[model samples]
Target: MDIKQLKFLIALDETRHFGQAATRCHITQPTLSMRLRNLEEELGLPLVRRGQRFEGFTAEGERILAWARSLMAAHDGLYAEASACRGQLVGTLRLGLVPLGGFEPMRLLSLFRRQHPNLRFQLFALSSEQILEGLTRNQLDLGLSYLDRLAREQFDSLELADTRMGLLYDQRHFSFTQTSLNWEQLGSLPLGLLSSGMHFRQSIDHAFRSRGLIAQPLLESDSVHNLLQAVSAGLCCAVMPLNGGLEVGNPHLRLLPIAEAHTLAPLGLILRRSAPRSALAEACFEEARRALADELRLSADR
Candidate 1:
């Protein structure tokens, strides 16, 4: 019935354990249970399914939990808006970033921090699917991911950069003395690639399939550093995005753009579209626009 009760419910849902949820809410387990019971009594519906331990929520509870998240989001947005009027934006901005190991997300966050010092940030390195899921669930305020996968009607976006796929390898390992490399050329090399479930990896697979080739990766990992390390050690070549957190000065490694890599898309920021947008989300979006404007302009000039 009250915000505290809703908070307790959400906490329980997140932790999936009564004791842990109580600890998160800074309340005793008994008190938390009493409040939730009172809430159930007021609503005349059973929210939680009872057992020896926390089993799960009822169907009704799932619906109510969604509303609870929306209510909390709106409440936080209102508070942020009020604080901004007083010349300081204060609140935690949760950001979901694709685990691309790129500098673009960090650069944007750094610029945002300088502009709004009072604001706090919680960053999560997630997959594109996870980022989208978090945004939909109201668990993330913003996400930095590939713009092509996001539904335009479901979310608003800002393109940060035009991403390009490339080949990463040690110059000493192979005889690939070319300005660019294509998927067909990469078919014979022992390669390191991201896990198959990842969007980045899926893109790589698609590119290879289009050329009637299949990549036989010697190493498969979710970590970009692992792939880079493999290339650095001359263990295998890698195919990855050129702008996805690649370090250009590595003496052992070289990144060459993939020839005719038209499938790679723009990487950018996304916010879930909702009525009465979060003040923090809007501020961050506008700030990103301003921060990237100069760079975009210079690129245009060149």
Candidate 2:
């Protein structure tokens, strides 16, 4: 019925326990219960099923919760836009990113802060699946992930960069006499790969399958940093993206590009189709586009 009621409903849905939900909302349990009861009375439909413990919501309650989330999201967006209209870009911008995408939030944050010094930015490193879920739940304003994996109807995206996959190894463990490796050459090595849930790993799997080859990684990780560490320790060679490649600048590590035509993946920025964009979001988007373009041009020149 009201913003407060909607907030309570969303909190309850997320926590699934009245006590935990009340704690999240910074309210007492009795107050939360009374509010939900009042809401149900007004709607003439029982929302949450009664139980000694936390039970799931009823059918009508589920529908109400869904609408509540959208309403709250729009209301929050309106507040952010109104604040931006006063010549100040001041609001929290929540972003979800795949760990291997090589997005350095600090660099972008530095530039963004110079333009809108009052803006707040929250960054979350998430797997591709988590990023997609966050976008659908209205928990993340934007996501950095593989463009090919996103559903076109539910979201919109802009291609940011081509993430080139390569093999990284400790020179102490293996010598890179060749400039690049074909899929067959890579298949011969004990490699570390991203977890199967990540788009990067999926891309690698597809490349192998298309060539009638099997990729059996010796190690698997969700974090790019961990994979780099493994390569530095001479555990195994790794298949990783160019952005992540920049982090493994150790003298011990050698990076060799994958020469197969299908190894490249495009990294992109995704956002909900109906979510409102704040001035800060617009500035961040423009900066990413510009940075990606510059990087592409430099790569072409080289």
Best candidate (score: lDDT): 1
lDDT of 2 by residue, 40-141 (tens): 999998999879977999999988887887787778777777777887777888888886664445666787788778878888988777988888877688
Worst 10 residues of 1 by lDDT: 97-106
Per-residue lDDT tens digits of candidate 1, residues 156-247? 99887666677887888866678998778888789998998876787788888888888789999988778888888889988877776575
Per-model TM values vs. the true structure:
0.84, 0.77
Question: Which segments of candidate 2 are over 4 A away from where they belong?
Answer: 14-23, 27-38, 46-56, 102-107, 126-133, 149-155, 171-175, 223-233, 245-254, 261-265, 275-280, 286-302
TM-score of decoy 2: 0.77
Q: List, in order, the clash count of every candidate structure.
A: 1, 0
Candidate 2 lDDT for residue 119: 76
Q: Each candidate's lDDT (Cα)? A: 0.84, 0.79
Clashes of 1: 1
* lDDT accuracy of residue 241 in candidate 2: 65
Error of 2 at 95 (Å): 1.4
